[model samples]
Target: MSELRFEDVTVRYGTGRRAMKAVDGVSLTVPTGQVVGLVGESGSGKSTLARAAVGLAPIAAGRVLLDGRDVRHRPARGSGRAVQMVFQDPYACLDPRMSVGDSVAEAIPRTGTAARRAEVTRLFGLVGLDAAHISSRPSELSGGQCQRVALARALAARPQIVVADEITSALDVSVQGTVLNLVRDLQQQTRLGMLFISHNLAVVRYVSDIIAVMYLGRIVECGPAHEVLTDPQHPYTRELLAAAPHRDGYAANSAHEESGAVLDTEPPDPHHLPAGCRFHPRCPVGPLALPARTDCLSLDPAVGAVGRRHATACHFAAPLPTPSHQAT
Candidate 1:
C-alpha cells in the first residue's frame, strides 16, 4: 500500500520579514486504505497543508514523501501525477465550456477514443453521476453534481493519494451528506490514501479513520477519530469540539466547561506569531482560565504522546474529567 507522508513540512509565503509559515513543522501520514482527517478553523493552515501535498503551495522546509520518495520534484498535475486534489469550489475547477465528460477525460492517460469515452462513463457512475449527463456542461449541473464531477476528474488520473479540501462545504446541507457518503464509499472501494480537510468536526468524524487537529500552522492534537473526539487532550481541540454543533452528544460531551470559555478572539497574526506556544494568547486552559504559564508564553511545547498513538502539543496536556452529559 502507498503512503503519503508530510515530514516536518513548513510552507512559507513571501520572503524576509514578510514571510509567513502557513504550515509549520508538521508531520503526518496517510497510509493507503485509510482516511486521515485534518481539521481546524479557517486560517489554521489546513488548506495550505493540503495544497502542499499536491505541490500547489511552496515548501520552505521539510518534505512531502509518497512511499518514501520525495514528491516535491514530481509532476503535480496531469495523469502522471500520483497525488490529486479536489478543491472546495467545484465549479471553479471545471471549464464552463467543456462537456463534463470531456473534462473528466482530460485526466485519463492516453487511450483509444472509444476506450477513453468508456472510461469517462465508468468514472461518472463511480462518483454517482448519471452516464447520460456526460455531454452536459458545467452550467447544466447542480452544485452537488459539479462537485462529483470534480471528484470524478481527480479519480480519472488513477492517483495514489487524494487530498479533499472542504469538498462538501460548498453544497447544500442536504447535499453535503450525499457527497460525503460517496467519498467514504469510494475510498473504501479504491483504498486510496486520503487526506480529508475540513473545519467541521462532525463531518470529519463521519468519514475519518484518524483525525489531526491543526491550530495556527501546527497540528496541536491527533489520534484515532474516536479517541480525539471523545477525549481531547489539547485546549484547542477541546474548544473546537465544543464549538461544533451537537451530534450524538459528542460536541456537548466535550470537556468544554472544564476547558474554559469559548475561543472568541481571532488567532494572532501569522506574520508576527506570538512567542512560545503559538496558541498561548487564545488558549482557554492557559491565560484565559488560569494564570498564564511562563512556559506557555516563552517556550514552544513539543508534541508528546498522551495515549497509544495519540499526541498533543501543550505543556498542560492531560485528559479532562468525563463530562456529566456524556452518552453511555
Candidate 2:
C-alpha cells in the first residue's frame, strides 16, 4: 500500500500581490516499507515537500494523503505524531536539559510508570543504545548518538513513516554510517516507510529505493533510485549527476558555480513565473524538435517518457555524448 501520496500539491508564501509559489503541482507516491529520497539544492522545494508531508507546512492547494487519510482532515499535530520527523540537526531537535529517556518517554501519553519504563528501555535497545544510558542528556552524547536518540523518539510513537531531513549531514563520515545502518536495521524490523530529504546524491543512493528530483518548485524527475541515477533522463538530473563528487567517479563541478558560464542565470521570480517548462532558462542542450516558448523569453524543448519507468521534463530529453574533459 502507498504510505503517502501528494496530488498536485502547492505551497505558496505571502499573500495577494506578494504571494509566491514554493511548490508547484508536485505529485508523488511513497509506497509502504520503501525509502524515497527527495533531492535538490537549497530553495529547490525539497524541504518544503518534507514539511508538507508531515503537516509542518500549510498547503495552499491540492491534497496530501497519509496512509490514505487526508492530513488536512486531522489536526496537524496529531497527524504529525503518526508521522515523526528527525531534523537535520540532532542537537537542535533534542531538549538540552531533558534526560534522553525523559525526552523519548514524552512521546507516550499518560501511560503507567511500568509501561513507560519498558517502552523507553525497549526503544533504546531498538535504536542500538543501551537502557543504562537513558539518564544521559543530549550534551552527553556524540552527534551519531543524538541522531539515534532522535530516531528513538520517532520510533517511540510507533509511526508508519519517518521524515528524515538530512539527518546525517552534521555527523562525521564514520558516525554517519553508523546512524544510517541503525536506520536501515529499524526499517527492516518495522517495515516503516521513509522520506529521506537531502541534496547529497551519494547518501540518497545508499538509502533510497526511489528518488524524486526537484527543481525551483517542481518535481522534474522521479523513478527507481538506480534507474534515475544511472540512466538519468532529465537535463537537471544530468547536471546534478555531473556535479556530484562520487568516490569512484571523476570529480564534478556545477556549471552554475563556474565562472563565465552563460547558464548561470538567476532563477525566475516565483510571482512572475516564466511560461512553458520551468528549466528552459538553464538547459544546455536542445537539438530535437520540441515545444516553443513564446509566452516566456526562454526557449522550450521536447520532453517525453523514455520508458515505462523513466520520464524527463527537459525538451531535449535524449542522451548526449559525454564531454571530453570530464571523461578522465
Candidate 3:
C-alpha cells in the first residue's frame, strides 16, 4: 500500500498583514496498517496537519502526497483516492434531524436505494453498530454512538487513510476508551493508515504506533510511540509527559501527589513568530542550564535524528529520566 506523506508542508491562512501559518514546514509519514498519533496543546496545528492530508486545509508550500500523487489532483472520493475525515464535533457535521443510518449512508457513493441501504448496512456493521441504530436520530444517541456514526460515515467511502481529528475529546472518559478501542480494532482489521490527532497523550499512546509532538505549528519530536512517551528527547516533549498526570495511586494513583515543573508561558502569536528557536524564550536550559547553548535564541533547530526512528528539533535534546528513575 502507498503511504501518505507530508513533504515539507506549510499551511497558511489569510494573506498579507493578517496572514498566519497554522502549520509550518513539516514532514510526516503514515503507512497503511498503522496509526500515527499527533499530540500537543490546543492550537498547536495538530488538526491542521491532518486536514492537509484530506485536501481540507490549504497548502501554502510543499505537498500532501498519497502514494506519490497529490490529493488535489487525485480522484476526489470514489475515483481512487479515498481519504476521509471524522471531525472533532460530530454534532457540527451531522445533521441533527437525520437518522444515524442516513447520516452514514450519505457518504456511501452508490446508486439506487437498494445499493445505498446495503452499503450503509455494511458500514454500520464495520463500525460495530447494529442495524437498529439506522432509524435513530443523532439527538437520541449517546456521544459514543454519534462518534461511531461519524466513523461509519467515513468508512462508507472506503478510504485508505482516515484522519481522526480529536474525535474522542468530547466523550466521557469511559466512552472515550470505548471509542478508541473501536477505532483501533477497525484500523487493524482494514489495515488503514490513520492520523489520530489529540491533545491527550494517554489516549494517543493507547492507539498510536508512532507519535509526533507539535508545538506552535512546528513538529518538535517524532519517534516510536514508546520512545517518545517513556523517554522523550526534546525538551518540549519531556515537558508534555512531565505535565501529563501520572497514577501515583492506582499503580501507586498518586497522580495528584507528584508535581511536574511545566512552563506556563503564553505561546507566541502565529502571525508574528519568534525569530530563532521558537521555544527559546521559555526553554528550561537557559543560562542556568547544563550543556547550555548560548546561541539558542539566535539559532533555529531543525529536526535531526536522535536514535532509531527518533527525531527532535532541538539542539540540546536529551531524554528525561522515567518516573522510576527520578527521585520521588
Predicted model with the maximum TM-score: 1
Give Cα-based local distance difference scores for all models: 0.87, 0.77, 0.80
Span of 10 residues, lowest total lDDT, candidate 3: 249-258
lDDT, candidate 2, 3-48, per-residue tens: 8889889998999999888998788888899999888888889888
| 111 Cα displacement, candidate 3 (Å) | 4.2
| Native-to-model Cα distance after best TM-score fit, residue 226 in candidate 1, in Å | 0.6
TM-score of decoy 3: 0.87
Model 3 regions more than 4 Å off: 74-81, 247-262, 287-292, 303-309, 318-328
In angstroms, the error of model 3 at 50 is 1.7
Query: How much does candidate 2 score in TM-score?
Result: 0.83
Per-residue lDDT of 58 in model 2: 85
Q: How many backbone clashes does candidate 2 have?
A: 2
- lDDT ranking, high to low: 1, 3, 2
Give the Å shift of residue 151 in candidate 3: 0.3
C-alpha lDDT of candidate 3 relative to the true structure: 0.80
Ranking by TM-score: 1, 3, 2
Name the 10 consecutive residues with the lowest summed lDDT in model 2.
287-296
